[model samples]
Structures are given as structure tokens and as C-alpha cells.
Target: MTDRRGLLIILSSPSGAGKSTLSKRLLEWDPSLRFSVSATTRAPRPGEVDGKDYHFMAEEQFKHDVIEGQMLEHAHVFGNFYGSPMAPVQAAIEAGRDVLFDIDWQGAQQISNSVLRDFVLSVFVLPPSIAELRRRLESRGQDSAEVIAKRMQKSWDEISHWDGYDYVLVNDDLDQSFEKLRTIVTAERLRRAQQPGLLDHVRNLQKEFEEISA
Candidate 1:
């Protein structure tokens, strides 16, 4: 049996950069990959489900979890607390199941610096251009004009962290970007360090070869 460790795939992008769409396609491409559901202190919006979209938590509880070191990574954004729970991530990786995270740069930084940093593969998605990003945000029509402006204003802050990621992809075409994303995942999974079973497998082969030579 080939032993493998799960990868912590973190995908980040400013709103409307097609991160969400790429994430959906990645999940569809590989059902074995698990999504890392985040915990948030913000109220659930319409159509959002608890434990699905987020594990909606109270501010106090969220703070407590952070203090207790139960969060793999966390941040306060837009006045709300958001975090990835540590336990599930630890569990998934041990079971050799890749865990995917759709989070911001802050959370990605936190995870990249965590104890399990070796397992993380962080990717940053960028729009082809700021103007195109604005157009996509506007086309969504889910936010008010004021909110869209605010998002655009903060987009630079997000883009500034592009260098922090292991890989950065400009989402000019969704299909092309997704293909690259898949290739990254596939290559990461094949790393020698990830295949712990290879050591034993090689040892067995050596013994067989020695017997044949004798």
C-alpha cells in the first residue's frame, strides 16, 4: 500500500476573482477532496446553513477557541471572527484525504506558519485586471454600489499578498486556470515526502533483489 499524507490546499482571492468558481470546479473534479468548513462569528445570511456554509459561533465562544489553540488559523475581518478548526484538519490529513480551504490571505498566512505547515499548499488566484474584477463584482449584483466600492478599495490589500502563496494563478480564463490548479494538486500529491510508504516499499524491493542476486 502507498501511504500518503493529505495536503492542506488553501485557495485565496479577493471577492469576484473567481476563487469560488474555481473551488467548486476543483471539488467536482475530485470528490475525494474535502472542503474545510470555517467557523465564523457573523450571523448567517439568507440561504446560508450552519455547519455547511459556516459553523456559526458566538463571539465569546470563538474567542475561547482561539485562546485554547483549537483554531488552525483565525482572523477578524469586517468586524467578524473567522477561523479554521484544527481538529478536522489534523484528522483529514492523517487519513490521507486532501482538505481544501477557501479563505483570505490572513488565514492562509496563519496556516502556512502553523505546526503542520509542511502539509500546506497555498494558492492565490488573481483577476486578469482590476477593471475586470470590478466588472465581475458589479455583474454579481448581490451587493450594493457602496459595498462594491468598498470591496474594490480593499482588493489591492488582498492582491499585495500574492507573493505569500506557493502558487499564484491569474484567472483570465476559468478553464485554463482550473487546469493549472489541478496540475498543481496532482504534482503536490506525488512528492516523495508525502509518500511515506515508499520507504518500506523500497526496503522490500531491496530484499527481493538481494535474494535473487544470492
Candidate 2:
């Protein structure tokens, strides 16, 4: 069989909807999957590794790249710039390696409508309830009360875009949601359009049958 084209799998959600954790789990489940490391102008967090967590860059450089059309999708969030670089994503997909993106709805919308839309599989994760969402955010202990309030407002905005995604999951339980996510990936990989080699395989089968009949 010929190599199948790689999928651009995107996961988007509100701040406390468990999208990040699920993304990590998916990466662990499929080691060959390439995670789309985004470029950002924000300062790195305490434990964030450069290039691994994010490709931290100066604002000037980031704007330069954006102006040069190197970014696949970008957004200005919370006074900082964040975007997916096109070159790395193209290289990975061309090599038949699926690329996973953990981004917000704005980025996802840009990519979903881009020239590479055919290869995109976008999923939106939703929290079970607003109350639960707040609880999860508080549990993290990473944000101050003010920041948390800001995020809560932003979360509502994010959740409003849920209908834009190809797949939607209400993440009431982590394990079940992950299982559903895995199933979606598996099914998408098996899609007829994703498997270009199927045409050749079917043609070969036809030829073999004709030869046997003769």
C-alpha cells in the first residue's frame, strides 16, 4: 500500500476544558504523531522549554515572519502573538506524519479555511458545565483571581465557537473523552480520501481477477 497522506488534527477548547491534557495523552498514544509547536512572542513560563513548548521569538521577528506569509494561522491573544509556522507543518504532512495542533478557535478557523483545509480534522472540546469549568480553573492554582475571571469570560467566547468544529466532545470524563478522541482519529485515518493508495490497490485487484478468469 502507498503511504497515506498525514492529517492535520486540531483540538480547540476553552481554558479549562481539558484540551491540553487530552492532547498530551494523544501524543503519548501515537508516538509518530508530530505535535505542531507554535511560535509565540510571549515570554516562556517557568518550566517551558524553548522550541519544545513554544518557539519563543522577539515581537519584531514574529511580525516579520507573519508578514512574510510563513505562518499558517496566527492570532493576537492577551497582548501577545501566537501562530503555527507553515514550513514545519508542511514538511511533516508531506512525510506522511500526522500533525496535532493545540490551539484556540481563531487559529482553528483560519486553518480550516486555508488551502490545506482538505487535510484538516478539527475537534472542539467543551466543558460539561460552566460551574465545573470554573472549578477546574480554580483547581489548577496557576492563575490569580483576576486572571481566572478574565479566562472565564474568554472561555465563554471560546465555547460560542463550538459549532464550527468538525467534531465536538463534551468532556465530562477524561477517559471516555480520550477514547472518543482516539476513535475519531482512527476513523478519519481510514477515510477514503485520506488513503490515496486505495485506488491502486483496487485496480490491482481488478487486474488479478481478470487474469484468473482468463
Name the candidate that leads on lDDT: 1
Tell me which residue pairs clash in candidate 2.
Answer: none
Ten contiguous residues minimizing lDDT sum, candidate 2 = 1-10
Residue-level lDDT of model 1, residues 1-214, one tens digit each, is 4399899999999999999999999999999899999999999999999989899999999999999989999988899999999989888888888999998888999999998899999999999999999999999889999999999988899999999999999999999999999999999999987788799989999999999999
Model 1: residue 43 alpha-carbon error in angstroms: 3.7
Predicted structure with the largest TM-score when compared to the true one: 1
Candidate 2 regions off by >4 Å?
43-47, 58-61, 209-214
Model 2 lDDT tens row, 1-214: 3468789999999999999999999999999899999999999999999999899999999999889988889999889999999889888877777999998888999999877899999999999999999999999998899999999999999999999999999999999999999999999999887888789989999999999999
Model 2, position 70: C-alpha lDDT score? 85
TM-score of each: 0.92, 0.89
Q: Which ten residues in a row have the lowest lDDT in candidate 1?
A: 1-10
